[model samples]
Target: MKPSFRLLSTVAAAALVCCASSSVLAQSKFVLKLAHADSADLGTSRKAVMADTFAKEVKAKSGGRIDVQIFGAGALGGEREVVEGVKNGFIQAGLASGVMANFFPGAMVTDIPYLFPSDEVADKVMDGPFGQKLSADFNAATGMHNLCFGEVGFRHFSSGKKPIHSPKDLVGMKIRVQETPLYVTEMKALGAQPTPIAFPETYTALQTGVVDGQENPIPTLIFAKFYEVQKNVTLDGHNYGIDWFVLSDKFYKSLPPDLLKVVTDAGKVACAEERKVNRTFTANGNKTMADKGVTVYTPTAAELAEFRAAAQPPVIEFLKTKIDPKLIDSIQTAVKDADAKK
Candidate 1:
């Protein structure tokens, strides 16, 4: 009972159709949406702009099969909120730090005062074995995969009320700090009353005398126009900030191997470029604060050491309640290693 030629040809045609459908299914496209809480500008928002570069690179490299969409400036809420969204698979990716310490307490290690001697030392420590461990710890705690780290520069103190030449100058001053316990502890230890304020309201907070002073990288102070309201600036370099480029474990797992490589490579490129911009701003752009009528003050080595003695020990004691001191010790060791190399 052999089939006729027409029947055999019809069976072969159906099999071919099934194979074509399977091939199409295997090559399905993936779209991931990444978010950040910066106003949409490369000049002001280093991480936001670089995260966008990650988006563009993913699209171009995936040949349109993978799309990384970006939402900036609280479009999906602040950094901590977006971090929650990503962990739940409600969002794909983001660039965040600060309140992220709440989710992954180990993250606050990066904010420890007087940790890095200079930007070069900080960079070496962060890109070395020490940083790798922190990234792994962060991934374990929060389920977000770190791609690369971008710089947030060193935070300095500025005041609208008075010039801060020493820790004594900060006494009786009301200082605004990011909504983090460690920052609060740091200010209290330095003899200032710490006011926890949201990022968006800081300028007005300064102008209206709600807060006498605040601390942040010079670039951020310039970008946010803090110089307009705060006339006194001091280079304290108390804390080094890191922008973590991360993808949700859920979204990362969804990608096929090839597309993952594309995302990872793009992240590295964006990280490098953003750090470069940060360094350049620290060297040249910071002088603008003085030009804009904000009195810029550089602390002597002895004065800065007084600040370190006053602020760091108490903050470390405070952090011991939240984070592993062992981790902090390891980081200190790494910083020393970096300094030794220099």
Candidate 2:
């Protein structure tokens, strides 16, 4: 039987649509949704740069076999939510911060005050054997693969009420701390009353005086615009922050050997790019703050010593009860090794 011309045309159109769908599917063999809480401004946000760079790297390396979509500025929710998503395989990847401690207590060791003497030492320790073990442990605990440790730089104290010169300056002030026991204990050891607060609510807490101050990396202070509400910044460099580039174990294992290598290698590249942008911002952040009318104070050597003496001991004691003492010793040993090599 001869079919009508209209019916033949309809069948041809349907066949074309099916072919197009198949082509699209073949081009993008894998899709990654990477999320973070940082601002969407790629020029100023290190997280954005890292995610964007990873997307490009993977696409180029795989020759269009993989697709990466980035969601910044809490697009998929805050850091915690993003971490949870990655763990459960709902989200493929995330740049997660201190919230990582909740799932892997061993990670809290990095939060020890004045842990790394300098950025060089920090890089050596975190990118060395110690980092490899930590990544493995984190993967075992959370079922998420740690691609690399991205820097959040060093955390410093900032206040609207006063300039902090030493531990005494923070005494009795209601400082906003992340909703973590280590942060609360660290602040208390420094003599400040630690008020546990969510990160998203921190700026408003500072402005409304719900909390007198907060601590974060300089780049965070600038991008989050905490400088607008807070009048003073103390470069105490209390803790060097480390954020993880995590991927869902399921998603990672599903990748072909070639694509898996591409993603892992691309992660290292993205990590380096993030650190470069972050350190540049950190080095010049004080000047930017000063121009914005914020008082930027760098403590004298003696004063910084006072901070180290006050915060490190108590935080160490607190951590001993939560994690193995041996892990803590390894970090200190690794730091010294890194310093000696330099």
Q: Best-fitting candidate, measured by TM-score?
A: 1
Residue 36, model 2: Cα distance from true site in angstroms? 2.1
lDDT (Cα) of model 2: 0.91
* Candidate 1 clashing pairs, residues 3+ apart or interchain: none
lDDT of 2 by residue, 270-338 (tens): 998999989999877877898899988889989988999999999999999999999999999999999
Candidate 2 segments whose C-alpha is farther than 4 A from its true place: 1-28, 208-210
Q: Worst 10-residue stretch by lDDT in candidate 1?
A: 281-290
TM-score of 1: 0.91
lDDT string, candidate 1, 1-342, tens digits: 356887998899999999999998675678788898877777667866787788788888988888777898879998878888988989988888675676788888888898888988988888899988988998888888988888888999999978999999999999999877788899999999999998889999999999999999988888788999999999889999988888889888888899889988988888888888777776665778768888888899999899999988998888888889999899999999999999
After TM-score superposition, the amount by which residue 79's alpha carbon in candidate 1 deviates from its true location, in angstroms, is: 1.7
